[model samples]
Target: MDKETEQLIEKAGKVYSENFSMTTCFERAIFFSWWCGINDCGFCFMSALPKEKTAKETAIRHESSILAETWLCRKLGWEFGFFTGGINAFNADKIESMLEKINKVYGEKVWISLGPIPKKLLERYKPYVKGVVGSVETINEDVHKKACPSKPINPYLKMFETANEIGMKTAMTLIIGLGETKDDFDKLVNFIKKYHISKIHIYGLIPHKGTVYSDADIPSAEYQAWWIAKTRIEFPRIDIQCGIWSDRIERTSLLLKAGANSISKLPVFRKFGTKISYDLEEQTKLAGREFLGSLTKMPEIDFDEIDRFGFDEELTVKIKDKIKKYLNVMKKN
Candidate 1:
């Protein structure tokens, strides 16, 4: 076995030794916030901080804004909170300041999901953050840049390196409908085997209203479930979970059965986190109603529908070809 594999096995042994539930103790994405515009990834959510026109002007100051966000999370009764943002957009000062405000206001109730960060930054935030999620988004750099105009912000491979050096349990996100072939996805999954990534979040491409890849075809449930299952076997010790897999609950449940253990529920809507600034309760309620409606419609788990997504001929052929190529490449290398 390779040195990485050997280490992973040792780590897994140490991990499974604990009594944490693979499913129950698995964390949830209580409040998710990002700091950039749509990248190459299908999702287009960004942060709500200072910038040019792209940024939203808030009534509150930065530190207070952060404290408010944390307080809202506590009030909403979320276990963990995620701070998703562009790697380039965040700085050590901003992170440090944010953490201090959060800790001072909310104490130690929520976790932060700071995106790909530097080793020093990670160490600085180590005490405040419960965990980190340096999602390379996609392993393919070409696809990554094309999707995220912020090229070089969160380079796919550099994230893995930083995660290892930081000595923090990490999380990754995969965009399933980013035009990657079966081989590409498999290669990425196999590549992820060499990290301290404790969670794998799978998000189907949700065409934002305005973005380059909005109209692209989203991956089928069958494709994602198979990928999740295959990944579970390949990286048996890792934690896997569906991220924003709301559109395909059946497939998501199949993935959960295969090995995924975490889910990111919808965040309660607030004017502070929206695209506009308004103190009017009516406007807030209007947005809140829409947001709550969307959250309520999230798909429920259905095992029977998942079972119907049988391994058809096309998928079987694709998966087999990819697996064979993977093995051959590994042998050659």
Candidate 2:
């Protein structure tokens, strides 16, 4: 709110425009594979320890949904699948089959970030995935251990090193307002610098029922904006994405101005039939940026590129027919 801080944030905004050549905070699509995982994270809202509760929804999911969702992401003019949750040793076969099929169509537009996978296991995914994520909520080891008792930070560091070594893009996830101090922020920047990390997905802690911090306060819009701008100022070329949570949806536009290139987790797959965050859309407009916030208006469908991949006839036809029908309905509307 002060002049100096305001001016710095403005500078960060300019850096984004200068580097990316766009004021648009593009809405990237990221849906989950949430089914089975050891939910030892006190801050986690989804999934549980296997024996603690049901632990997950189910291991077996419709594989066809993978192709359909990937196509849907393309139709909406967004990035390919970035999956998280599930895909563990217990139920790797079914998930691997789906991702393998996805690789043939979408190629390297995928990344998975639920947790660290061993070097051998991660390499296998390298063929289909373009990037991998290491969750580094805080560089302060004390804070990290207290917050995530079961999750270790060193493996994520190793994961980053391996990902870079193997010629894959390296990304990270960090939750703001995890009781991290100002010094921890500096450590975070240093960690990124050391690892040559490319992208960061910043999440605000939103308390959820049945979690340890269910009554925790969500980070303020101003705090979120300040940190994001600081990160952008430090790493102008780094890909920064601020999360938009429904709980604190009011912070939407301010977050964009803080130098996040996109509101990267929009549940955009739901934008097909279900309504999207029109409020967040309004916020983007307020920030003078564009995002796909409605299904009524559609982007130009690139059929040639779609056909060029030589995907299965059955899957291809299914997606195309769906698109055609949707387009027709849009035309009528």
Candidate 3:
């Protein structure tokens, strides 16, 4: 990173420390409710996903698996159940049913990322969810339309508007390397001003194979930090989550300094198995922030936390047994 961006990041860190205090929480748990849904987003990897894995053509992840993933995420100390899937007709009802079950078990730990549902549906989910999030990737109408083709920015803004009107917290996800303009960033500020979005998730776009930009360059980490820092400088109070995968968890320290309060996509699996190199707690601790759960270490399956973060006694026993077996099996491996 350049000196100027470094200074800005430092400034953002100070602002974050002053306003929110520096605590990084791995609160996001992305449960892919469906997969391989057809999308017009030229940059998305789903477009390249095979027919069998795609939602519209083949099968979606089972509801049991979906619920299991949520339970495991909550148990692993993630704070929100972020339900996202490919665009399809069957998604709405299935998501509503899953939300009902999750609401009963986890109580307002839901956030839906399914694209552009009706206003009434958003209202229906209010009782079951903490908030709703959408990818308002960019407010550059023409840029969004040209790249997404079918998925425009307005519909997501409408969803966000409904979320705000219904008193649910709102967040928008934006990709940094998608030909975003300076004016686009300016519009994002106005967008948060207009819609009152409480959080913004930023990622550097990594071009996917079989897509139009398959051969495009990946945005450097410094570029990612630049935008994240800029955002923190702009909205010092807004929650900023820097997107990371299992491979790049070490970036947690850098992002924390760049003013990101959280990072994305922990290594939690459907059956609660994780395969990763970085130690999440240590990484966040080195960043001078705290992580909510032990990322690599499994705790003693405490009953108190089970009641607080997991399901009822019967289900908890089943889950606990499974976890123990899984750990033992890993030990042998």
Candidate 4:
């Protein structure tokens, strides 16, 4: 590693250790994306770009990016890692192959948010994945349809049901401020009670520039906090997470008091123009929660083992170059 990279790693390690009380905990998970293009979801802030490669080539790149992210997660002492891309149909074979590889290295330490998938496919990959997130975004069908024109609400609910039936840990996200009413929360609570979801993520919608919803109004922190507290009261045993996008310390502090016990997808390094206001440790401290480290005891991982996960030399070099750029940019800033 170069000097800048070394500094970042050291700083992250020290801050992580100081903020968190345990060596292994579920809250110490990181988030990365396997794909950046749109998945035909109109409400998505991410825009679709023209396809540059065949399906096979795109699949390879996705797998390679995931492997590289895994290596970074291991180095950061995070207990869990998740992949997020907007709802898109994936090549099932390619995704299965990628999950199998990740399971070998991390052993169910990873989760993924794929909008909605088939039941058979979920069952096939359930053993390799720790959890699956099928975000309905809103319980109101009309509101959901308005936000995501291409994706329907019923299938997403079905995906969660299928996950529960197969005994896979399941999660769902509710984005507040999408013109949803109190009735929507009641509907969601009933669904959660019936489905036995292991976790619930609450995020305030960010009106990204150039998106269809860019002109939409942002929800107040107080409004977001109220629902978060309500969810905690309704589901005392389940994990409630404040997502990365809702980053204000004041909001997060209230969320913790109202019963949020976890946070997800903290970045290991801050890139330019990123909106991250606090690191994992800082967020945990703000909420007066203990920051836990890894969830399992294991020997140190060998870096060379990453090569065995399957990536072409060109892809491997590309990932390395990206990492170097990330570190150098942070150093300059």
lDDT of 1 by residue, 192-288 (tens): 7666666677766766655676577777755665556566656676766555433443443334444444444322242222222122212323212
Kindly indicate the candidate among 2 and 4 with the higher lDDT. Answer: 2
Model 1 residue runs over 4 Å out of place are 1-77, 86-91, 101-115, 153-156, 245-247, 265-333
TM-score of each: 0.61, 0.82, 0.84, 0.74
RMSD of each: 18.8, 4.1, 3.8, 9.6
User: Which parts of model 2 have CA positions greater than 4 angstroms off?
Assistant: 23-32, 47-60, 87-96, 105-108, 267-276, 292-333
Q: Model 4, 186: alpha-carbon shift in Å? A: 1.3
Candidate 4 TM-score versus the reference = 0.74
Residue-level lDDT for 130 in candidate 3: 69
Give each model's whole-structure lDDT.
Answer: 0.49, 0.68, 0.69, 0.60
The full ranking of all candidates by TM-score, starting with the best, is 3, 2, 4, 1
For model 4, residues 111-167, the per-residue Cα lDDT tens digits are: 777667788988887777878877678787888777777777778778888888888
- Best TM-score goes to which candidate? 3
For all candidates, the clash counts are 9, 0, 2, 4
In candidate 1, the residue pairs with backbone N, CA or C atoms under 3 Å apart (3 or more residues apart, or in different chains) clash, namely 34-46, 34-47, 34-84, 35-47, 35-85, 39-147, 39-148, 40-147, 40-148
- List, residue by residue over 209-242, the lDDT tens digit for candidate 2: 7777777888887778888888999999998888
Model 4: pairs clashing at backbone N, Cα or C within 3 Å: 23-294, 24-293, 24-294, 25-293
